[model samples]
Target chain A: MDLEFSPEDIAFRDEVRKFLEESYPESLRGKASRDEYEREDFLLWQKTLYERGWGAPAWPKEYGGTGWTSIQRFIFQEECARAETIPIPPFGMNMLAPVLLAFGSEEQKQEYLPPIIKGETFWCQGYSEPGSGSDLASLKTTAVRDGDEYVINGQKTWTTLGHFADWIFVLCRTDPSAKKLQEGISFILVNMKTPGVEVKPIITLDGSHEVNETWFTDVRVPVANRVGEENKGWTYAKYLLLHERSGIAGVGRSKRAVERLKEIAATEVSHGEPIIHDPTFARKIAELEVDLTALEYTELRTLAAEAQGKGPGPESSLLKVKGTEIQQRLTELTLEAVGNYAAPYFRGFPKDGDNAYPIGPGYAHMAAPLYANMRKTSIYGGSNEIQRNIIAKAVLGL
Target chain B: MDFNFTSEQDQLRDMVARLMREQYDFDTRRKIASSEPGWRPEMWSQFAELGLLAAPFTEEEGGFGGPIETMIMMEEFGKGLVIEPFLQTAVIAFLQGIIGGEKIFGFAYAEPQGRYNLNDLATTAKKDGDGYVLNGHKAVAHGGPMATHFIVTARTGGDQRDDKGVGVFIVAKDAKGVTTRDYPTVDGQRASEVYFENVSVGADALIGSGDDLALVEKVVDEAIAALCAEAVGCMKVLNEATVDYSKQRKQFGVPIASFQVLQHRMVDMFMAAEQAVSMAYMVTLKLGEDDVERAKAASAAKVQTGKAGKLISQDAVQIHGGMGMTDELNVGHYFKRLTMIGQQFGDVDFHLKRYAKLSAG
Candidate 1:
């Protein structure tokens, strides 16, 4: 089987590369790669992309998106990743937007889609609670109907970008007596500014403030905000979870990491020569490259299936498990390349400060931080252990 | 972009699989194991007639002009416990394709003290007249008992540790002062050690001499790919046999396959086999590229496949209970073949160390 891209796809890739090279601000690229972007800086960067009609390539054009084919979208993302440009955050665009497009009422889509497209509103996910990760149906979040409005009172921990969000899509139990656990849930949207909404930072091992514990107490949301039918939130949640897991594959980002690792290996000396010259290290890189190649092919298979107008089946779990593993390995290898330079634990280094003593190179300060930050990949979007179980049950019928 | 075999390749695989099932059954394999040289010439002739032996070589050398992936197909054949010298023949064909000659060649690099290191040759080759006089003994030469020529490696100039000075020679197996001690391995394969007492050969016998240890390394790496592919095939058979036995074999008033934990273990075996197959395919694809890159990819596949083969074989045996360890069952044959394949072209640790060194660069 061949692995070469079509000439047209290559040309599209070139166009994407050229656009990213010219349009993506150097400051944002540097900060994004360093995992040091502030909320405002991210908004500004996303707005610039939105203004250029380059944001949300995977979304439909009728909803202020580019309406690209799956391969084109894949190409766009890969180029952006290889160029080290700021990524369009998945919470709003990749995760919730698809749900809004497919299941949200027309007026609801009209109200929320424009804001997301214009970068006027940031979104966060409210799927997981204290007790409901892999066994997500056991969630304790509650939404009670009270005349024209529903009061949402629950807590969502590990809320990525919750502090910056103006809106959130949550899955809460709307039916206490429904027979099946999956039949008692409902999907609803809530404004972050609603009364009694609070976001408390949950500091991760990386010492980053990207995640938070969001609590909603007596938060009022109009009945119009509910997506689809009542007690059908599990269906919508499953749909959204697929989107989340698919993006979690991170094929583009891993490709970029491999490139950056190669560059660093070429420059860094290990045994009186560039580390890239070391046969062992080169072989390790090559091994990762082979894995990355296989992952890329698997991704293409998924995309090709989507192009044929089908949602991902059990094979998506395979992609999710292997893709995240590869990304984790890439991050580990990146840190390994930096060696002792990545050993220092810089807690909360400012994004725009001059106080931090940059380690090894300007690029290396983020190695440890990136490694620490990515520790949650396997935990979120379904843990690898959970994915294995899914594979065993769904694909192998075991 | 596509990850499927062509219709022709598909038919070829199916044909080979059917032929293996019908003609090369377990009883036939046992007979071959007990034979004089532990191999059947009629089987080799059958493969040659089927054009399987010539699939991986070029038409210029009486081959099909196919790529290394063709050789991978033959490797899978070896995994079915087929008692034949496919690897020995394919490797000779591959070297002949590269060296551009009709001369028969058998690899003579592994030494008693070298420990699977291809470049660690101790034999010396000194210039005498218009040729070189080889003075050393080569051990564990597969197919050396029947081959017409020997592709011998000898220390020329550099230090023992210096891989740069190793030279490769194609010496006639029947040359004067040549002696052989042939025997059967535990896996029912024949191999021999040959002594070189001033065995002289013309300068034309040298394939690619001098400090080109890289080429020598490539030959070894390619051989590893072939061996890994064979192991993959063997693992596939073992996995399928285990699954079938688990479904049919009963225990505690029910089929053993009804157990969830055992099913999960079998699923894991399937996953390992699938991953190994994917990596082996990739290694075959990269075989004709840059030497270092090829070596790196080949070593990764070799490492992964070697380890996975061992695990799957062991698990297959465990799934069959006591029957798996007995000589009457085919599962035991796969176990022995997998063990032999592991040590054939540098074991898992050797490849992993190689992979780590290349990656650490």
Candidate 2:
């Protein structure tokens, strides 16, 4: 019932704050604070946190993590988010690691865990095929059994960070003739360096190459790399999807964005006074703040359920839908705050050679890009429309 | 931070909700609305007996010592379209208790030209020998016609636009030269315009000495909180009614709820209700603290609740199709109540302006 942390937790928070102040590289913090971190910068930040034994605060201590309590983990995340530090990539820590910890063989854990903790491996998800997003069970990615290895052949579009990834975990149809579409799938881990694997860039409307089309052309993966039971990959996939959806709540990042929005609104002027002085805009921010506060409570409830040894259930879908909506609203408000500074399309901006006077700052250069990038949040992970269906069926029993 | 009510709060809510549902059903409300007084005094006495009337007041002032959160629970009272003076009575009770008054009281703030601004008072109270002579007319004064006493805000010195020098007085409803033009509002509740023509009051009538405008502002802000809670209640009913009607009513040989568009809209309605509930709860928690903070939070809730209540009620009626607008239908009651709730305390634009001003500062 109490909102305040204990004295010990407060002290722990102070220690974490001091460490963040001293240890996070200034250049990396600058990029993170500006929301313009590159792949290398993110990796270096992750490695720094890992070296300090502060990476993956949600993971068990035995897995080279902090193993903090749920509230402590939440506090750490809030602080890290508010501090504008680079968040550990969810593809490695939030999405795949949990699945590997739960369903991978001992050898698989030993092999994947260390590389992930050491920041030596960069992972991208290979889940959504072109025709099989919300209806994911209809995926046609085939992984034919070939003696001691499976040959994967299919395309995974919207592969976030695929261009930077060295590894990919995929769901492929292993037994096409199984009764249920879900029954035929198997989870496989493949190296991006395999001879037949290819990645083609998909430049988004934001004119950023953050996403890619990953093609697996008979890419051979070891049988030992298969997670859990063969053809039972649907279970593991569901587990991973829950983790992904839960992470998509993005409470920490959104809180930082809200603070940034407030700051920008306070500084940016419209109608003579700062835009934040406008009641309409300020009211929108206040309403968003209140919604974020409620979302935080909903997230804590879900985490409390997990702390009691329960997997994320249908309620996580609710968080995903509302969380992404809030995130989109934050971006919209940020663009509104930036006003004319955010008008130049990223593609229209000069990139090389002679004419290259940046319109505002590097941050303003990414506003349109970030806005365009966030357009996929509701579509990926699972479209909010699909999440509502899940909530209707599972939570509301409609 | 927990979002759950304590077991005792839950029990209290359940008891009040049940009493409202059983005793103040739509049929009973409709019957009372057509009666001479427009509201049933027997029901008010029943609420008093159940301690619902005293729920938000302190024990020393013939009340149950309930926090503002208890007023939020009273939102359910609005859901049933209960025709009683819970809000008017409770707010006045709290104010009177705070200012050391023993009698039941009612608020008189809204004026014919005030629009929705509580600060736009044209009333004047001039100092007389050992007392004050009040001269003003107040509109939409809920329970003013029946209240034992009235808390009337009047400009003592400064200009009408200046909220400073605005003083609040406790005048008995039966004070000399006081007259009430009472009538039933569209929501089937009675409110009155009380005219004070040189109505003199004793020294004790003044709640606080000289121009403490902040106290008057605080009272108005708390009254807005009470209204927001009631609006949340009204919207909750509207949401449920919409969902239920959409589930049962069939079109094209299937329930309308089967359509994704309607489902999404219902989800939106649910979200609005959820946000309003959260904001109302937070404002209730801070009610006893900072006045400015309470004003900001309450305005936030009012803005959200007012808009949501209107949207949900309108959509609920539309979802019910033709029967929704009929006086015979219960959903229409919710619709009427929601409309009334929006206009009460302050409407969406009023609160939004207030919120913007506070946040801007």
At residue A216, what lDDT does model 2 achieve? 88
lDDT value, residue A320 of candidate 2: 93
Provide the DockQ value for model 2: 0.01
lDDT minimum window of 10 residues, candidate 2 chain B: B95-104
Where is the poorest 10-residue window by lDDT in model 1 chain A? A340-349
Native contacts recovered, in order, as a fraction for each? 0.00, 0.00
| CA lDDT, every model vs. true structure | 0.74, 0.75
lDDT of 2 by residue, B303-356 (tens): 888778767875676555534534566776676567557657666655777888
- lDDT string for model 2 (A33-56, tens) is 545457787778888888898867
Model 1 agreement with the true structure over B39-101: per-residue lDDT tens digits: 666666677667676677767866764655465575557655765555655664365432222
What is the number of backbone collisions in each predicted candidate, taken in the order shown? 21, 0
lDDT string, candidate 1, A1-398, tens digits: 46677888898889888888888876675665666566677677778788889766777888777877888888988887887777677888888889988998899888888878777788999987865665688777899999999998889877888988888899999998999888989999988998978999875534467777889899989988899999999999999888877766779989888888999888765333676887767998999999989999889988988989988777888888888778877876676566433433344434466644432355556675565455466667876667788899988999
